[model samples]
Target chain A: SQTIHQWPATLVQPVGSPLSLECTVEGTSNPNLYWYRQAAGRGLQLLFYSVGIGQISSEVPQNLSASRPQDRQFILSSKKLLLSDSGFYLCAWVKTSGGDEQFFGPGTRLTVL
Target chain B: QKEVEQDPGPLSVPEGAIVSLNCTYSNSAFQYFMWYRQYSRKGPELLMYTYSSGNKEDGRFTAQVDKSSKYISLFIRDSQPSDSATYLCGPYGQNFVFGPGTRLSVLP
Candidate 1:
């Protein structure tokens, strides 16, 4: 069975602070990884997606960036956080073969004060 | 118009009642449709996935896709309090697009 893990399940940061969130997948290789943010009562906004190492596609322009440093490891980072950057951040992966079924890790609740 | 749209229903229903959730999209190129369920303050979980323009059924859920109408639906039978959550619709391709989740509360 495959499992996805995310760290710092809850984060509270002040404005202008640096941000780093990590996601890792086990039992799968070459999976499609994605980063999304969900605001209260709002739809999810796709931030970034990576198909392979060193390849990242950003869907929205924001204060965040993503990197696929390893095949199973993905990281979302920001140089400085904004108050608007606070939300429930989710990391999801889909098997390229399965294509449509996406598995998500327990999200990180980020609050930028 | 947004590529995908779902009613942010805060919909309330009695237990054992049938529930219907729907989404509409303007993009015709979407080949795969999926439904995700998210509990409060949790990540979304894949509940149903369908490719063809037909119905796909699981134990208590049924997912329907109508390519011609560019619409999709998720139906839940014998709803329970545990079914209270938000339902999100995703239309897929290179970048999966998620609709605004519909919040459902099943009263016991």
Candidate 2:
């Protein structure tokens, strides 16, 4: 079985501070990774997606960026955080076989104050 | 206009009642439909996936997709309090277009 791990489960960051959130998947290789943000009572907003290492596609332009440093390790980072950057971050993985069902991690709740 | 539209309902229903959740899409290219459930402050969990235009049933959950009408539905039989969460419908093709989601509360 494949499992995704994301941390820290919750984060509180000061405005203009740096942000880093990590997500790692086990039991799968060369999986498609995606970063999504969800606001209160809102649908998910796709931030970035990577089909392979060092390859990322940004859906919406913002302060946040994503990187796939390894085959199963994806990281979301920001040099300086903004108040609008606060939201629940989710990491998801999909098989390369064109299956649309994506498995998601527990998620990280970020609050920029 | 949005690619997909869903009623953002804080729908409250009694336990054991039947629940119906729906979504409409403007794109006909979406051949795959899916329903996801998300708890408070958690990631969305895929509850059901259906292809083309038809109905698929898994246990107490039934997913229906009508590509002709560009509409989809999810039906929960004998709903439980544990089923309280936000239901999001998505249309899949190159990627996915998700609806705003509907929050359901099953009162016990």
Candidate 3:
């Protein structure tokens, strides 16, 4: 069985502070990774996705950026956070078998004060 | 028009009642449809996925897709309070277009 892990389940940062969120998947290799954010009471907004290491596609223009440093490790980062950057961030992975189902991590709740 | 549209419903239903959730899309190129459930402050979980048109059932949940109408539905029979969550419908491809999601409350 495959398991996804995310850290700092909850975070609070002031505006202009740096942000880093990590996601790791065990038991899978070369999986497609994605970063998504959800505003309060709203649906998910895709931020970035990666097919392989050092390859990332930006879905929306924002202060946040994503990186696939390893086959199973993905990181979302920001040099300076904004108040609008506060939201629930999710990391997900999908198999390359042509199936569109995405498995998600527990998620990180970010609050920028 | 948005590629996918769903009613942002705060629908409240009694436990054991039948629940119906729906979504409509304007994109005909979509060949796959999916339903996801998200609890408060959690990531969305894939609950159902279907291809093309027709119905698929898993236990108490039934997913129906009508490609001709560009509509899809999820039916929960004998719903429980544990089923309370936000339901979102999306189309599959290189990029999935998600609906606004519908908030459901199964009251016990």
TM-score, structure 3 vs. true: 0.97
Docking quality band of candidate 1, CAPRI definitions: high
Estimate, for each residue in B4-47, the C-alpha lDDT of model 3 and write its tens digit: 88999899999999999999999889999999999887888999
Best by TM-score: 2
- Top candidate on DockQ is 1
* DockQ of all models, two decimals each: 0.90, 0.80, 0.82
lDDT of 3 at A82: 99
For model 1, residues A20-111, the per-residue Cα lDDT tens digits are: 99999999999999999999899899999998999999988888999999999999999999999999999999998866688899999999
Tens digit of per-residue lDDT, candidate 1, span B1-108 = 999999999999999999999999999999999899999988998898998899999999999999999999999999999999999998886688999999999999
CA lDDT, candidate 3, residue A20: 98
lDDT of each: 0.94, 0.93, 0.92
Flag clash pairs in model 2: none
Q: Across residues A1-113, which tens digit of lDDT does each residue of candidate 2 receive?
A: 99999999999999999999999999989999999998877888889999999999999999999999999999999999999999999999999888679899999999999
- Global CA lDDT computed for model 2: 0.93
lDDT of candidate 2 at residue B92, scale 0 to 100 = 81
Kindly report the TM-score of the first chain in candidate 1: 0.97
**What is the alpha-carbon lDDT of model 1 when measured against the actual structure?**
0.94
Question: Total clashing residue pairs per candidate?
Answer: 0, 0, 0
Sorted by lDDT (best first), the order is 1, 2, 3
